[model samples]
Target: MVRKCSVAGCNNTAGLHSFPADLKIRRQWLHALGLEDREFPPRAGVCKLHFTRDCFSNAMQVEMGFSSQLMLKSDAVPYANVTPPARTPRPQRRPGASTSSACIQLPLSRDVSCQTDPLETHTVGTQLSLKTLLPHFRSEGVQANVSCKDFGVGMSNADPLGLSSTPVKRPRLDLDEQLEDDALEHSSLEEALKGQDSTHDPASLDSSLKSADSSTPTHNSKKYIVYESCIMELFNVCPVCTRACDVRTQRLGTFLSVKQWCPRCTFTRHWNSQPVIGSVPSGNLHLSAAVYLSGASFILIEKVFKAMKLQLFRYETFQRHARAFIEPAVIHHWKATQDVNLQSLSQEEKVIVGGDMRADSPAHSAKYGSYATMDLRTNTVVDIQLVQSNEVGGSCHMEKEGLKRSLALLESRGINLDCIVTDRHPQVQKFLRERNITHYYDVWHMAKGISKKLEAISKQKDCEKLKKWMKSIINHIYWTAASSTSEPERIAKWTTILNHVRDVHTHEDPLYPKCEHVIRKTTDKSKWLQADTLAFYKLEKLLTKKRTLKDVAKLSPHHQTSSLEAFRAVILRFAPKNVVFPFIGMLCRLYLAAMHYNENVDRPLAETEEGVPLFKISFPKSRKEECRVKPQKTQPTFGYVADTMDLIFEKVFVNPVPYTDALLAIPVPEDLSP
Candidate 1:
């Protein structure tokens, strides 16, 4: 029969056993400390009130080293004289039936109210004897802490109770299955919103999202050929040919949509891709464009393309279409605007033109070869020719042919002719002499030559004398005037050094006469004429940047080839890092990439993409300064055609003779002679 609980507001049944007064009060106290799960000995148990209140002191004593069996016989044992109740047999359930069961059972020694057992000390007899009332309270309040809907640990499907049905199964997948799944999901989304408003079309929205993604790479190739052709044919092309609204797939609000774009024009919002078959090219299959782009050596350029959500296609159909219709039209347009001026310019500019060749070092240095030219006066490169030079002489021939072509172009236009300068490269000099091109030795080159000689001298037995003699000669040449009026004094300075060295040591050469003449002469025509003292200072400045002589020598070639150095920096900033294929198209792309060097593309203020220029900024050095007498605008003075001509033009050595002009008729510095 049920008996009401003596505790206030606790009307639940007392069931078979009831705790007496003191034990009930002690049980209440232990329940507050959450140690109410323990039960007293059966013969010593109290009624329900005393069982819940006073049982904790006995449980605490057991926890404090009193054994349960000993506590059963101790003074804390209630109803020590009463006989223990006989235990009931546990019910058995079928295994399969248990699987479907939604039951949460806390251990007999666990508390229902306290979720956390900071000490795990909940006992059976302390709070209310669960063991004594097991038949009555077994299912009641047992699942109170757990929820029915919780998908507990390891479970893949939701459980009716707050526990796992079974260990969660990892979805087993094959490569094909994974791909198909992705494709199905993507296509399903595309199909769902297919007929929505054009403004909210799924494909159009998807394209816009892709454009947003593609803004980071140094270069982006959204529409290789077919798409561009379709755009031009379908929609009127931009006059500037900068911007086009080509929609690519992007998702917004769970719909695939398109975004119209123009690379030349700035737009505030994304346009929808017209899925009308022609928006993209017909018979053009989309392959992994991302894979092809990843193969590029220029990391930034690849990233830029990726950012634009563009893909490259090497399809035969696209290539044929580009060749048949697009290329011809583009070429025609380019020719028509070939003379258009794209750069700002000023009059009577002080331009310093420099050129250097970069060829793979013996096929052993493992380096790509190219020739580049820069205007030091403005720090802007005007030419970069990528011609292969390999172990096979074919590459060399190609390089020579390329150089010849460039020289011809430059000669066609009057550029870099006033006071050209270069290092003492025999091949370059040979090329220059044949063309009657007036040039000078870079002052830095001359100083380095002197410095190298001095360093060698310092290693000799007669080092001090030789070093002093070398210094005097360098100072005399460096400080000497270029005018013919100072020729006699220059000759006297030359003679003094030569005589001193001859008297102190003996050295012989068959070309002594030619050498002596070089020693005696003071001509601006010599390739090794000392330039401004400032040039020597710059060389020294560069030398001091390094620690050892080897480092100085190793880096010295780059110093001489400063044009190539500048070009390398610009290229690195924009080009791919790994470029294995030497295709002409890629070369053209490289040219475009170089053209975009240092240009800042326009971007919105809340820029989500990094490394994209919000607006274009021209190369700073493109323009010349205003002359003292005549004021002029700052920009490229010559139009694009003329600029191109200036870069490739070399009046010297358009045609080479075998014997006469190819010889070194030029003299060397006074110190090097004899």
Candidate 2:
């Protein structure tokens, strides 16, 4: 039987609301219905027509067409006028006709009677009731909650719910098998609920149901290189009318759109492959940002896309994105990171940093020079300053200007420097002296300069014997710097090279009176540099050079700028010298490289499965054909790329005006061409 409004005048049954369980609310509802004098029947309800529009809690949603159901607010009472209809008497049951034995009563606020033949099972409303009853049945006894009596049949309690009391006779399965079955059932129920929930859109329900039926995992939201043919398959037939559709596809860089119209049923649909942020497609913006952050060349990536017949944005579009969003994010992130680093450094008594400048090209022809400073203790790039040749008056002076800018930045952050290590450039030395800053020469830089002179001398006729001692001389420079604690000790150890090459271990200097190595008789006399020979004379003069001695005395006893050199190599990946970039573009790329270096510089070396340290043999060009073993480090991660992407999408994309303003504030130099 259909439910009707409990109000006497109303016969309407749709959109009915059950009376609230609270006694006071129920009494008020009955009073409004003019039935307070009579006893209210259990499970009685009032049609929505009797309630005013203000009674609905979702009144706005209903009015805006977002919802079809009218939900009454709590404490709401029916006050709308009801017109009385002709009264009809209840139907009388025929004699000898018994109620259906399979009838089941539902546990609802309003009574809903269901009946069926005893031989046929009634499945309607069973699943919903079981969902509500399963927990109670599990906690208590299932037999006590559901039984033959609930099916309108009286039976003994021993055979409750008409289920067999004895356990199954089949052999028990393994624990894994039981768990697998339980997991499958749990997942099935979860999928069923996801599909059946009314709040979910039909498109989502369809996708969820399809996922439940498939064995493979979904990758709809992940990045993929999809083919045009594969995408066309989805639009071949209209989903609404199940007929042939005239589908049109449009492409804008990495963005794609599809429109389908069915000729038979006039069905139409439009879809885009990527979300749009303002006027730009999100995919296009992300691609441009990723390319810049990962130190990838856009031209190379575009070529790859072209070879694969894939769609991609133009270089101009990439530059536009960089200027508008990616560049500002880099500047913002770098400054924020630098501020934190500086604050941390400020707590220390004295910070020893290694500073260096890298030119975009060799010699005076270079257009740009970037100065990078690293905290020696942590081996992290703390700050980088980019200088254009034009700003510094000449390419030769860019390095000095870049270093000055970096020092100024560090000074502004209140970081106190105990000492700094750099190459012995005359301009740099003079500048540091004027400021009274304690400066030392990087051992590698001094050693490299000495090695070049020795290499050239060894190439001359009769000076070929010097080649045998070149490697030993370079190694001695590092040893002298590493072993000595003072200028006297460093000079004494360094001068020992001249005596040691002539098969002499005794030295005149009291700081290093004798060689530290064990005395041994030489089996191959040819290896030793004999006194008074041309090779020996050239080696002594070069080793005893006034400038060389001065640089050796100030060799950095602590950290060197090798890591800074490594950072310059990293910059090559971001801003290659072969490719020209605008001033801001070069600065942003330098920032990106610095971030990448700072994040991964201290990564641990890779290890084998047995916990043994791993190493790889490499033949470096500088080492000639000789192979050297180096530790194989763990894979470098691009976490900074993700951070940059987040910054762009969450902050920059939302309100780019502030970020653009910051980018615009940077002074970009005039183009060289015109």
Candidate 3:
């Protein structure tokens, strides 16, 4: 039978000499690679050598000299240069046996020359190597299988190649050799395991992992993270000082609570006892003078928070803590000015100062209101005090004391006064006269006096009309007094109205006994009179009769007590309505707000180059000099609030008095407790 050529496209029968008859495995490879024989033209069969060269060249070209197609073979063997048939055997020699054309037999070695030598004995210097054994075995006609196919049982009939040769049995192992082999194998296995552990160093590895775990946080660790906040780390250590001194204390802690104390320093400052003011603000706070100078009302405070975008805090808590922070600065600034005395000022310059007072409800210790004095020209508040008085005496006593205190402050500052103008309060009058200071009544206050009297004479509703009419008369009276041209005219007009009011009120069922008494006692001798001149009377009547002048004068400049009222407004602003901490915080806020106001006086105003309108203050040319002189006594120009503890404490004792029930009874709604 003819089998097709394994090469592609050839019809010639494949001969045993080229591909060999036992090529079942080779055929499978060819088929899988799509390399089976194809039809070649008639008489166009390729010889084995040419076919091999072409295949080698094609493989070389495909891979560009990557793997060589050159086959290797032993030089001494026939067909060594060609692919050998499977199951071929290689020749080998048997132990202690030799083969020859005559016979095969085992031969005794030369070392066993002695007849007593045992069969197992051999010379110690002699050993057989595998290479020597192969050559000797080949000479004995014994062959070894070289290819994997030699182990198969089937034999190929077409090719004289097969691996059915019987394998000789090796010698059986002895007991000692078997035991030694087991020991060597166990030792080798143990050494291998130990070597692996040495390379890895499990102990050091475990320690390294443990140390690494300790230094860093695990993914699930919990932290009390304060959002958008920064904290300044401060050391608690301080220099030793045995002597006690007042100081405000603050603590560095995980939470806002203050607990520990350092007894060594013995320094206690006002502690911020309030709760946390919410989260830390995200950005830096930069407040302007305008904001500082504004009233310290809760509204303004809230506005400041809004401007900064700080998270809002509880209103009460915010007020408490904010006041604590701001108050000290205020007191520091105010106290700094106390050393400057007004008396040292030139008389020609005159420290034209005004005094005023208002009540603070949250303050527990002071019954009388807080007092303030300002230099009218400078508009700066020079001094302030809290006066205490019994609810008893009257507003009159409070006024007297406040005036005295205001004058004392000027004297302490060494400022000298030339003249004073105020409402006609008896206490203010007495104080001014005693000091021999020239005094003029505040026209606005005088107008109020008239209105107050008329109001007493009418119903609560009719007081508005009475107030309007009285203001007109007060304005005309002042005009007559200021510009009458003659004392007789001023006196005639003043007395004529006084007599008319007295006569009209005497017969009627009166509402105001004091008003009736005041009218009946009218005289040219009083200071309310400009002069005893006749022309004053005619001018007063003519001016009073005119509707335009009356209207103008009625609303006239008499109400210009804006300076004193401004002082009250400032206190209200800095001291919120709901504060409950004995009103001490209020004082602090007040002081700070005032200082802020003064500092901002130099700010440029849009309307003018002269800068903002502020209370006038002048420092001496010798700016290097520190103010240390004692102040001189002076009279205050503004009328003080009447007959309260302010008079006794401020005027008589020159100290703050204990609070009375009357002052406490006055409702103050804005006090916030922290």
Q: Which candidate's TM-score is highest? A: 2
Cα lDDT, model 3, residue 418 = 65
Residues 13-62 of candidate 2: C-alpha lDDT, one tens digit per residue: 88889889888988888788777635577768888778755576544333
TM-score preference between candidates 1 and 3, better one: 3
| Candidate 1 local lDDT, 349-380, one digit each (tens) | 43345666545345434334456554555444
The candidate with the higher TM-score, 1 or 2, is 2
Kindly report which residue stretches of model 1 are placed more than 4 angstroms away from their true locations once superposed: 1-352, 360-368, 390-402, 413-416, 462-564, 572-581, 585-674
Q: Residue 249 of model 2: what lDDT?
A: 50
| Alpha carbon lDDT at 583, candidate 1 | 38
What TM-score against the true fold does each predicted structure earn?
Answer: 0.33, 0.68, 0.35
- List per-candidate RMSD values in Å: 26.5, 19.4, 36.6
Candidates in descending TM-score order? 2, 3, 1
Candidate 3 per-residue lDDT, tens place, 1-674, comes to: 44544344444454312332335643443344344445322232222322322232122211211111222111111121333222213345456544431121122322111123212322111111112212232211112321111111111121211112332132111111111133332353222112111133222222211112243211112323332222111113211222222222222122221111123322111111221111111010012112232433555657766786543434443343233222333343356444442433534356565666665553344344666665566556666665444532443366567677777766665566866555566667678878898665555555555555554543454223333345446655566455433334444434445433323433221222222235444464322423244333433454345442332322222223456665566566556555533445445455554454444333442332365433334454333354434232222211111111123212221211222222333334333322
- Residue 631 deviation, candidate 3, in Å? 37
CA deviation > 4 Å runs, candidate 3: 1-325, 337-349, 361-368, 390-396, 452-471, 484-560, 576-583, 592-674
Show model 2 residue runs off by greater than 4 Å. Answer: 1-220
Could you tell me which 10 consecutive residues in candidate 1 have the lowest summed lDDT? Answer: 148-157
